[model samples]
Target: MSSTQKPVSSEDALGQKYDRCLADLLVKSGVGFGAGVVASVILFRRKTWPIALSTGFGAGAAYADCDRSFNPARIPGTRILPKAEAPASK
Candidate 1:
């Protein structure tokens, strides 16, 4: 241990992670919701809640599973997005 360094407790680490995840969830969902509204308006030419909600959910899911096309686990909670897969060699 360094003289000026302090050990981080498990609880603190967990709290920090929780805060980050919550923030990510809120930001991603908000952006998705906004995009959905725009898309719905463009497609239907009217303000519709149902279509907007559906598209927002889809967009949020896409954001959570950014690495892959889709991930089922994303529906549960905000998750740290998975790492990108390495490109396959010929």
Candidate 2:
């Protein structure tokens, strides 16, 4: 018998990972920058550090998410159960 699915190459896997990381970085960093801008304008008297700080936080969060995606075992509250086996015939 033959399997129907195409085998995935290492390059394809790497490409997929890179795509995920890039998307996460863009989205997270954008949100963080927006938040920083708001905080800086409202609370910090238009300081530049808040924007930088929040952007860094967002980038860091993206890094954590990408790391978790690459290493699922690092995720919190995960459980791995054993498979069941059939009984032997007499």
Candidate 3:
């Protein structure tokens, strides 16, 4: 049995690269938020309200960073995928 390989077009390759970059940014941001939340809790327990607040701000900043990084403004001229394309199995 012979299997034919389908070549990826430049557009497809670019799309894949963009997707990977966006995904990595999101994952890292999520990790940052999680770590921030944990640290905030720890600081709160230690009676350090200022540190806890700062950690909470860090989480918010991480989320904003993710949004800004993935935003169309940051990646001009690239086609934005529809919401349906978000699922990995799709």
lDDT of 1 by residue, 1-90 (tens): 657868999898778766666666677677767776777778767668745686568556645655332344545565665467655559
Q: Please provide TM-scores, in order, for all candidate models, with all chains considered together.
A: 0.52, 0.74, 0.48
Q: lDDT tens string, model 3, 45-88?
A: 64455454555565566556556655756555767668988657
* Whole-model Cα lDDT of every candidate shown, in order: 0.64, 0.92, 0.64
- Top candidate when judged by TM-score against the true structure: 2
lDDT of 2 by residue, 1-90 (tens): 996999899999989998999999999999999999999999999999999999999999999999988888789996554455545559
Off by over 4 Å in 1: 1-3, 47-90
2 or 3, which is superior by TM-score? 2
In what order do the candidates fall by TM-score, top score first? 2, 1, 3
Better of 1 and 3 by TM-score: 1
- Candidate 3 residue pairs in clash (backbone atoms < 3 Å): none
